[model samples]
Target: EWQLALELLQRMPELGATADVISYNAAISACEKAGQWQMAVALLARMPKVGLNPNVISYNAAICACERGLQWESVLDLTRQMSAARVAMNTATHTAALMTFSSAGRWQEALSLGPGGSPRAADLGRSCGTLLMECEQRDLLAVEVSLTDRLSAAAREGRELPADLALVLDLSARLRRREQQPQELQGLFQALRRPRPQGGGRTWASLPYQRELQLLRHVLTEAPAGSAAAAAAAVDDFGAELGEAGSWAKFAGGSKAATLLAAVRGARLGDRVLEIGTYCGNSALRLAAALPGVRVTTLELDPLLVAIARSLLAFAGLAASVDVWTGPSKLLLPRLRPLRFSAIFVDRWGSQYDEDLALIQEHELLQQAGGVLVADNVLTTAAASFLWQVAHPPSNSFEGAFTSRMLAVREVAQSSEEDWMSVSVANFQADVFRQAPPIPPELLALQAASERLRERVIRSEAARLEKGAFTEHAKATLSGAGIAPLE
Candidate 1:
């Protein structure tokens, strides 16, 4: 059909008929539907040569074609041309352009377009809603809030809500609640963690951590019981798999992994090490494998990821030597007192690094006899406050606290940009500080809230596993509580 459409447009000159903008628009649309974006652009260009000025319709058709083909640049160029030619863009034009931008991850450009002066609020709302969904999918919570704010402003100006009005209001209410909480409490309750896309009989191949899980499964299946050589070979095969997937830079790999391993080795670690972010259990596996007889305690917030990490550590034959705890680091750190870590690795979210370190000091989790602490992804997360506190401890609170050094290293082997890691050694004696700082009342309240949320999640997950589906009452409870139900 598209070929016939193209042929008919080509033969218009031979048939002695001057093709108008309407004829060109039809052909372009056919090409768009067929995914022949190049042909669509060619036809659009041919119109100008044939003395046919392209109108908004012609341009819209061409933009839609480029969008369908995921040609974001072409869509941008066409939109610019439309502006230059004084072709007023309608809702369709804006929608196509925004969709193209979102598909290409050009979120800034998509946002800059705004809900234009097109009188159709419904159309604009639908497009913005779609964009918000995309942002949530990519875990861009900040961008989601920014876009929601823009849409909320439009609504305040009397624009009607989108079809997904619940999502908008829910996010707005969540944001307002977060704003009222204490600064330290804000991070704990900022957003309800959505379950990853591995539920509802989904294929393992579709999981984001599929490759890591696959590697773990392979190692477990291939390695013989109690054979070091076989274990090493299995690990090598896993590395080869990572190479094939070009993923050495991700999930605690590449230069970052090497640097972390080197720092741990150099620390002259004692009997135990604590890792704040387990994250597939890569660091725990490496530490346990590299240092025999040393115990590794790693914490992860997501229960699903904790399961995966535990599986990976068990597969590596290091489960006996490693512990994977499931909960927020803030809540769990306080419970680790009286048992000191020789070395602590802080590899969680960058925003939480400073708070976790402060908590570590307050709880006396690190050995007073020169224990080492290493923090990762400081530069990438712009954790300037953490860096500053480490380099310049306050005289009143942290005098003679740490001897710290900052290192700039590449995140991956092929990455051009560099990230930073801070390695600090404790310098105070245990007798010098008999009394640790008291936990704030606000922090205690936040910890209690987090525990309640964790219990709810545990109950929900247990119910789902037992019943094979969430009951209507459970769904209602979660919805009323502003938590998204597991898919």
Candidate 2:
């Protein structure tokens, strides 16, 4: 059909005529839609040869064609060419990058575009397993190790490590020890390794915890097992029932939301703590379970959410040390004494993530002496914007590399299944806003500068990796490493 379209074009229009943009676009689309991608690319070469020029729309259409064809290298080339010619990369260009990324199963790339919302780290770990399998099939060890590091980082930072990730870890260890075993032999090694259990059903029994467990059951029931009173507790509004342990439910599995939850049966932390978001009491329950040895005071913006979290706490049987209040921080924060907090986790109004961070800092609630603050979804612009605004010469990143890694994360022109859909398709539905980042002139420049430096460093590292010289010492990067552990 593409051949027919091209042949009929000149024949119908006087056998010899300069192609107009519309005529070119029509042929391009016809070739793209017909799956004749190489023909479409060949037709593009005709533009320069025939004295016809490519416009922004022409470049966009051509990129879209290359993108849809899964002609990745071609897509990248045309994209760069458009840039060299100063063609504007409107929303269409950016969107195509996302779409193309998805097609190739390059999920990280897909998720990084203009890029709001990251998948829960656990989901990324799951994808790492799938990618590892694909790499094994293709016998691509270099790509496999790179993907494994990404998986390991996500898992170490609280993404659930699936069996495959564990295998990757074991294999990575073996490879480091100079044993690059065959792919077909992975199962034997896996079977020899003791299986890791899912700590999904964490049991707790302190006074506050039991009651809150009961309340949580009422709110979200069909309890797992072995907790009768917990499974039997009431689920209606918590404030209404003075006896109810807790209420409210948020249906996130740390899958899409990028917030992973571990039901710690026995965990310990300092007495004074602050949390930024309280959707239901999912995190609150886990917090309460950790509080037998300490006190935890959390803040929330919604009374409904507060009530729900409160019930979960009451049901779980620990409500005294936990305070679930609903209101803006401006009003509530002033009430707390300065220098009163030991830890704070930020996970609220993404738009105001920066503001709340400042509040936490200025009020001295978080002392510089080992007061930990874990900010969620910093991968997104909404959170990054706030972070960038609040920066001094030094930034509040996890490490020196955050600014760059966040920006040049190798985005593509598509979203593929092993792609964008893999890490965060669901979260994207809830987040879905990618207009220009809310950047002021100064901060925008700062962000651009940070990204530029980051890109340069990454390029140098990639060069090293390519030269077969990228190596880690026998000790893990974990020991006083630049990256922090989630727990």
Candidate 3:
């Protein structure tokens, strides 16, 4: 169908009818739906040559194509081109661009765009929540406050807020309140609730992760401490509660937990172990409890989850054995100083597994000779690229042949869904770091442009804040002198 569409457009001139913008748009849309991103982009580029100016619909189709292909840089480029051509972007354009940026973890760029005119609540909430989480994780308090204020104003103007945004805002407010009252552990309960905008039928309390943290807190508070047996018992109790509440699928328990624990126990790890995902600290708790001597360093990108994991770890008496680092694995991996771990567990984004492994090797975070790398949810996450790379290691990337196995496990107890965990051991004869592939010239240019745009946004925000403060001060001074301030 896509081929026929493209052919029809190309033959328009031969058939004595010139291709118009609408014809080109139809071809691009066909290609986009068919997953032919390159063809779609080529058609878009050919528009100018054929004397047809690309409009919002043409650009949106191309952007959608690039987004579907995960061509984040392309999406950025298309949006920039739209701006240069003075094509006013609609909500669809903004939504596609925001999705691409969010998928690529470019939260700053996504936040810079903000909620465009007449945006869908679901799309806007997801983008805002992701950006806010990034800010929280990076300790960007100013940016977080600014974003929440913008969202609050939007809500006041009758914009609907989705459940995700409401949940994140509640958590953000609670965290701020908790920081003010460090001595009060129950500050979240006592903090004055903000008037929530009504739209989504869900509340923060109904969130599964929050419920999991609460259950863990209650169970650990009641259970005895100071030993691995007690911690394991607490985890079991927590799992049982989740099952009763029909939320066990969210937790990494049952067969998945058993397989991960088995991999760790069989790894013969040394004094250090690294975990990439620390959701509720379930796996970290299990690893610490299993090997009391091995110190565990876990990385979690979500600040809320990091706080919950830390709380659960402390309550389970394993806080001393595990250190939870709050940030994405990509940013945190390079910062881990000279501390090589004998075993590394990866349970984060499956698409980043290969890239993170390369980072681990480059930074020498994993012991070269006998390091064990265990990756969870490989099959379900469609991590075929990672599996193939580890199985067929390039000579330059790895020192020696690597041995690995894929173990299938049930995602949840008595559930039909199955997942796989890959456990691999290194057999390096010498220390070597895999050299990262060079970025394409086009991508480098796009990166430079994105950086410039980000700086411009920052400068614009500073000017706006400065102007607002000056206006407020002027009004106060005029009022004190018995003169009405200028409207």
Candidate 4:
């Protein structure tokens, strides 16, 4: 088959058709699959002579061929060319490089790729297994012993290891050791067995987690499973029961409005979920009800609104599953533990989306693989910038970059012509091998200076508000002071 492909490719010029990069790429792919490493390299080298630049795909195929032939040097050389040519290395390229390093007993080089180097976690385990075998090879035993001793000493002193090395240490003991095996691997494994800190000392039980767990168990045990219709009926029954209790608040979007979110989220729940705005607890309840196993943390700026949400949640028997933090998200987000959220829903003020998005990125809050970020009411003028961001996010910003879609819907109770909401759902595609570069020093300095200025302004404004003299300012100046006019 590959021979036929190559013959066709060579005949392109004879057929009066110029061979382009795509044609070359297909030829390279055929060579790679057929284990024709020399042929693949030859074709790759010939591309530049034909006025065609080898892209990442071209490099990836060539690297895979080298990997199959145990040609680590060629793989490394191609990777360097990828950098020089400014080609973006995707997951396939990284995986191929790692496999080549593993096959050549270059365990240290493979370990430098980091835990996120592979797009799929399962593939990462297979790579680790290969690296482990290399480490155990008789020729590399001395280097392995020295590395294990150093890593174990570091672990005993409570020092953090590189992310890839940490993962390797965790998996070392799983492999069968050979005769006369060094004790270093055993020591490293034992050193990492101690329990680590959880949630940076913040309390979750104070939010009454046990009570929520019991309630969730009851709901799940009684609900019929096996189909989507059953789940929807359960949710509808729960919503009706809450409404009958007279605590249901009239919110902008209801069950119908949440259809897009439900469809994207699917049946299984994630470990951690974040809600940017908890208005009257309707959305929070819906999220908790749908994803019963999920841990939800909601942020609300208004104290009165927080209290109302708490009351409504308690009335709906969902107080245990959701935690309500009473403060501006900008202030609270920085204080929360550096835990990655598998899903984040934004229903807050649209103008603050950019600032909040920056904070999320700065803190590394999204899951390292793929996560979901959903925003509501995107049709509003205030949300224009936010919509533009999801629609056209920076390339390779997150592990798996975000791919977004906007769904149009009518307002919950208003006429379609009078009011509307657009829900934007973005699916993140994590490429673990793509590490974001360090932030520039000037950008860091600018952010620090802006933060200092904000603190001073906030102090001055708070003093004026406490003294009840804030209203004396000119109307034009009041707007800048963030003071709302009295009704």
What TM-score fits each model?
A: 0.44, 0.33, 0.57, 0.37
lDDT tens digits, residues 1-487, model 3? 9999988987988999978999999999999999999998999999998788999999999999987888888988898899899897776677677767766768677767765654554344433545555565567777776665665444334334323333334434444434524344333322212333344455545433445445455544556544556655666666666555554334566677787777777775789999998877878988888887899999876554665666556546676789776555666787675888889999864545777887887787877777888888664443444555454433454443356776767655235455567787877644443332343343333334334433554354435344334334433432332223123
Ranking by TM-score: 3, 1, 4, 2
The most accurate candidate by lDDT is: 3
Kindly list the per-residue Cα lDDT of model 4 for residues 1-487, writing each as its tens digit.
6798799999998899999999999999999999999999899999999999999889989999998898988887887788789886776688678777765766566766532332332233333333333444334555444444444333333323212233233333222223312364334333323333323242323321222222222233344322333333444444444445532223434444465357437422457788887755566767777676788888875432443455445435566688766445654666555777877777754445657766776676766445666665443313433444444434545532454555544444332212223333334433332233443343334334334433554354434242123212222232232212223
Deviation of model 4 at 379, angstroms = 1.0
Which tens-of-lDDT digit does each residue in 210-286 have in candidate 2? Answer: 34333443444434222323422322233235313222122222222222222112112356667667656555555
Please list all clashing residue pairs in model 1, or write none if there are none.
Answer: none
Worst 10 residues of 2 by lDDT: 417-426
Please report the TM-score between candidate 1 and the true structure: 0.44
Of the two candidates 1 and 4, the one with more favorable lDDT, higher being better, is 1
Best by TM-score: 3
Ranking by lDDT: 3, 1, 4, 2
Q: What residue runs in model 4 are displaced by over 4 Å at the alpha carbon? A: 1-252, 393-400, 417-487
> What local distance difference test score does each model get?
0.63, 0.45, 0.65, 0.53
Per-residue lDDT of model 1, residues 432-458, tens digit only: 642334433433343343344335553
Per-residue lDDT for 93 in model 3? 76
Judge candidate 2 at residue 266 and give its lDDT: 15
